[model samples]
Target: MAFAWKAAGITYNRYLAIAARVVRRSLKEGPRLQAERRGEMDLRFAKWQNGKQGENKSLGEANASAMAEQAKAE
Candidate 1:
């Protein structure tokens, strides 16, 4: 069984983003501001190798770059 988003030719991440945006827009002004702030991806991640963790990097940036690479490949 194929997912609806897949049938629509949209990635799962893009579908979730659209759903989140719709939910945020449906909120009242104050709560919407809070929700928008909460949606901000200030995430950080580190690569682990040999039981050692590398320096932290922005997860958002990494994902963005990876998506760009995928787009290029496609």
Candidate 2:
């Protein structure tokens, strides 16, 4: 989550605020804003998963490792 925030330069809460703004503006502009928001979110996730430029393993792999450890512990 911290990595996600750093990758986006905005925390989840800040993203929510931006989302609210986008929604309000979208009411006047229509559904195009939704696509824009989705694109931006995808870019942020990609950046986080890639680690500066996707040079590292994906977030899925990270989460999987964590889950595997937890299962082993149990």
Q: Largest lDDT belongs to which candidate?
A: 1
Q: What tens-digit string does per-residue lDDT give for candidate 1 at 1-74?
A: 99999999999999999999999989999999999998877879999999999999999889999999999999
lDDT of 2 at 54: 52
* Collision count of model 1: 0
- Tell me the whole-model lDDT of each prediction, alpha carbons only: 0.95, 0.65
lDDT of 1: 0.95
| 29 Cα displacement, candidate 1 (Å) | 2.0
Per-residue alpha-carbon lDDT of candidate 2 for residues 1-74, written as tens digits (9 for 90 to 100): 45665698887888876777766666745576665665453112244444556545556676789999999999
In TM-score terms, which candidate is top?
A: 1
Stretches off by above 4 angstroms in model 1 are 11-14, 63-74
Q: Which ranges of candidate 2 are over 4 A from the true structure? A: 1-6, 29-74
| Collision pairs in model 1 | none
